[model samples]
Target: MQRPPRPSAPRRRMPSPGTGLTPLLLAALAFAITALLTLGAYNSARHVAQANLQNTFEYRSRDAHLALVRRMAVYEEVLRGVQGYLRGSVNISRKEFADYFSVLRLDESFPGIEALGIASIIPPGQLERHEQAVRREGYASYTVHPPGPRPVYTSVTHIEPFNGRNLRAFGFDMFSEPVRRAAMEAARDTGQAAVTGKVVLVQESGWDNKPGVLMYLPVYRAGLPAQTVEQRRAAIFGWVYSPFRMNDLMRGLLGEHSGEVELRIYDGAQPGAEDLLYLSPGTAPGRRPMFQRTDVIEMRGRPWTVVFSSTPALEAQRDTVRPLVIGLTGIGVGFLLGVVVWLLASERGRALKLAEKMTLELRQSYIRIEAEQRRMRVILQNAYDAFVASDAKGRITDWNIKATQLFGWTEREALGRPISDLLVPPDQRERHVRGFRRFANCGSGPVMSAPTEVTAQRNDGSLVQVEVAVAALPTPDGYGASAFVRDITPRKEAEERERQRQQRLDETREALQRAQKLEAVGKLTGGVAHDFNNLLHIISANVQLVLRSPNKQQQRLQSILDAVERGSKLSAQLLAFARRQPLHPQVVDTARLIERMDSLLHRAAGEGVELRHTVQPGLWNTLVDPNQLENVLLNLVINARDAIEGRGSITIALSNADLDGDALPDPEMAPGQYVLATVSDTGRGMAPEVMERAFEPFFTTKPEGKGTGLGLSMAHGFVKQSGGHIQLASEVGRGTTVSIYLPRCLREIAEGVMTPGR
Candidate 1:
């Protein structure tokens, strides 16, 4: 709104004599300070990177050591199982022992076991007799190996699978050698497992030689005193032992463990070339490790020294200059700022009005930028999902509020930590590294910017299910990454619960349909059986009458009468299955009913099946035929006995359950208080398809001639006719449980009744 100044010849102001060099001096000072700052920042960054490298090396070393300990412990436990098997019997034959060992499937269970064998201590006198006994068993070429005998010779009498390289160890005299003899003696004297020192295994072929060790678990004569050292040595029968090759052993123990950490194992407590059992492949000779640590792990009383060292690959990562890149970026920005200040200071001779206007504009711009930054921080802090950004080296650069809450690591703790170490699970870190490497090298990676469900780690060492959307960020130096992560654990849990509920719902519906089908079959069978019974009655009467009147045909008529009688009996069984048998219904107490059957039920279950009863006091009463109920219980116990193999237990548990309107156990059952009598067996369970048709007539899982297949069908008919619902539940290896829910007697009584399901 102000009038423009009149145009005039611009005055060429002369530079002041005192201020002439001030701009140059200020510019030089600014640059010098900036250079010093940049140098300090770079040095600090390098120091921090070195510190991180040391920490990473230590972590990997500890991990490798722990892994070795765990793998060895598992092998020791397996040896214990073998030792237990030997002590369980006194006369274990060669075939029996071989079959037992074959079940172990050593390669699949634990990859490095060279052989599991039994070494028998051969007194000098019994050598010929032992050879004769082994020869009779089929190893014609078997003989004591190494062709020498000590005071007490021990030969591997049984080693399996009797094929492959394991065959080479057969008849190998272990007690003749000092290393093997020492471990065997340790096991016998201490009555505990022991491991031998480093040795070339007898199982090694001529083409290969790997450091090997043997684990020995002593076996003593059954029913002998082996508690003390002298007693154990005297009664010791032999030892169950296994051999291991260190190269294959370590490979199995430490799968895909990165080469950043070099592993070396020594057989004894000290690390020496003579005692070196294993040296990890790819270790650069003469390349001194940047980080090294030594620890000893005791293996079955034998100390194993493990050495872990950092290699050049680890050093390369530490020398990446990522921290220097970050520091320089920051310092360069400050340096440029200093140069701008120098330039502004140099323009002091300009118009005061214009200078004031430019200063105001800069102040406004700075305020606006600061306000925008604050706004951004507030938005990030309040975002719903966790937000994290990392540099190309996978170092966390920025973290937001949601990330802090989700990961349990505060912003300060997570800022410079590797993203994989902080968030990626231990098992998945390799994949994370590969993805980042691919993006950095090829500028492309796995489906970036698309949400993917993955497992993530928390600071507390627990895991979380997260859906993360990652985007690659191209920077001046390399590729970086930003991710939005949402915790999906709650949603996954909800889905699981819903899935289970739906499964249960489907099962109940299927059971209801099966029950309806059985009911229809029962009605049809009952009508047909009734007509057949009437026709048989008439035929029997006519045949008997004819037999009385005839002489020559009397034998044939008598045979016809016998045939009719058998048919009539079969019809009676059919009527029973149909629940059409005549019965006198009476009020029965559920608990008292089981109490009266104690002797009868036990006799039916036999000694193998431990019969048990759990009768709930004050059980509800139901109206059912007393005799029919007794028959049902006896049949159930007998059926349960047949269902079980060897020793098992059958429990008849009685409890009162309420089937309310909200969630009736079955659609066939009305809302009411019911008496539940559950007959559960620790026996072979039924498959789902078998359980569905279990109530059908002539459906049996038993051998063809063993059962009539009418037991469950008749029982089902009896329960349904008595106004009850039956439910069957089973798992393939676990067991089976059958429950019968009978409506309580409407009339009031002091005691109650129960239904059966087995």
Candidate 2:
């Protein structure tokens, strides 16, 4: 500690010369720079707000146009259906036409189409007869209006619902008006639906005369070819047309009012009263909108101009800004600048002490920065992934220890080598070189600041999958790039395996649903078959007894007996499909059984099919009913014979298979050894839809009265009841295969073996 000095007396000093003017001058300079910055910020904010408001207006315009076009398309479909009926029918009757329209319920279901009507194209001479023909259909006073002699006359002959609104247009001549005639002629010549321009419809009364349009679809004669304009006119029979009011259609589509935007629609390019079809409430002559845009939409070969404008309420909501924030920010910044200027000029001695303190602080900052660099070096050396640094030319400048371990290259060997040549695959080396040049020239690349998946080559010439992220480092000359790479081979393989497992699960679920449905149908069929079989048994016994008592062969009695025998056979087939037939099961070798049936199978297959059997030695034995097994084989063999059109081969293969818990052939089969029996035919196979229902009883592709559709169904039921699974695969025009997997038996072949025919 040191001793304290004596206090000195305070001295008063006068202001220096010109010091008062200096403060005023400094304050004026600060205000000028602050004002310039504040004005620039305000202008930029206003411009940005205006651009955002313009985009909002344009988006709304497109949405309104799409809504109008989509609604008009729905109305076109209604006209096409009516046109099709007229062309298809030979003669149109009054009752038939009325019944068709009554089912449509046009007024209740479709609000836009006011009424549907038919207009006849009549000659001047036959006009009287047409009127009489209409009167006979209960319309007494019908006549073609605009009565005059012309080359052709189109008069409304029939209109549906027979109401006051539709009756008003019963005799109006559509050919007299130019606007309606243009649409009709287009429909006849082009064979398509056409819409007319703006006009007051004939259906309107005194105050309801709104702007409306008509849609016409032409109907040609039944047997004529209307390929040209001249031929189409000669073959024209009539027209199916409908009328629509603009106000009613717009109301149903966009409601009574659009809250945020005003709309105007015009018939064509011009925007005058004659061409203007519609205008919203606030879009009248004198109202000026804040933001507006125009779009043109095409409907049925006619262009409609649509203009969308933002209302005052919408503009105010979108463009509003906070004035208080701007004012406060400007004031705060000005005050801070004034304080800084005053401190600099008035406290020169204090400034000197501050400079000395700043020098000492700078020295401490250098020590802290050096310590941070050391920490970063430690992080790079101990990181799990490789971190490499390269120059603008892609020469490796720095390599971490992880890089050496990953690529099997020493740091000494990796330094000063081109990055592409050292790590990138040979096929991708040229592409990497081109990308590096572009990055150096433009200071940007697609791979910068993002992770990318790529293949990299190691020193041993093996490729590895890696995920790389690159960052640009600012250098004294230009810029350098640094990359961090991580191996991702294991992750990719895991993702692929998971995808395969999910696919198998989906297939299993679909198969299970089909099996459940078929099982329910089989149960129902079995109950019905059991009851019918009892009735047939009683009938056959009585018929035989009656014939014996008569002691004569009556033809009718013989027919009755034959019918009973057929019914019993059908019942047995149903029982087989349901797996309810009586069975005595025993272990048997599939190879020996097939050898016994070799000759019979050839006879059943016919000369067109070449049958062959390939049986594996030491095949596992399966426990099944011998009689049922023989029946199943006969059904399968006959089915294959029918499938072949001319000449083909049918092969039977027998083998042994094993099923695991994770890899099961079918969801219903247990994990164990199985005996597989497959019957394959090279013939015109079934389509996908046919193959899906191939196992259902009474479902078949064969013609009626030629064969019963219970062959495959019976085989499916028998195999499932015998603790086995069945699978079928077929492609049209290629072939068909039916595979049966039965549970294997471990018992020795020592019991009595049943012959194939028995």
Best by lDDT: 1
* Cα RMSD for candidates in order: 29.0, 31.2
Best by TM-score: 1
lDDT of each: 0.75, 0.74
Candidate 1 minimal-lDDT segment of 10 residues:
342-351
TM-score of each: 0.42, 0.40
Per-residue lDDT of candidate 2, residues 1-758 (tens digit): 88799798888888899889987777676656556654654465466456656655564555566557756765665565465445322258767778777766666546677788888787657777778877887779888888777777878877886687778888889988899998899988876678888888888896967888888877776555565778777777778888888877776444322566787788876667678777775555777888887877776767778888887766775533522233344445456455334434423553465457545544554454465445445556665568788888888987889898888888899999999989989999999998888776655565542356789999998999987656565466556777777778888999888889888988998898898787857854674565456656666766777767776547547756776777776667777777886667888888888888888899999998999999888898889887788888878888998999999999989999987764586676789999999999998998998988798777778886666677888889889889888999899998899999988989867757564464
lDDT of 1 by residue, 1-758 (tens): 99999899989988788688897788678667767766665676567668767876776687677667656766665665565445323347778777776666566656677777888888767787778778878879878878864678778888887788888888888988899899999988876679999999998887878899999988776555554678778777888888999988887343333667888899888789999998888887888887899999988889999988898887776744544553555455445665434434532432354457546644654564465445445545655678788888889987999998999999999999999899988999998888788776645444341256788999999999987655455577688876777899999999999999999999999999898888867855774576566666767776766767776476656666676776665555566777787767777776877887788899999998899898777787888876777877787778778889899999999998886554587776788888898888888888999998787776678886687567777778778878888788989766788788877887754344343322
Off by over 4 Å in 2: 1-37, 89-91, 94-99, 102-110, 255-257, 323-329, 332-758
lDDT, candidate 2, equals: 0.74
Give candidate 1 regions above 4 Å deviation.
1-26, 88-91, 323-758
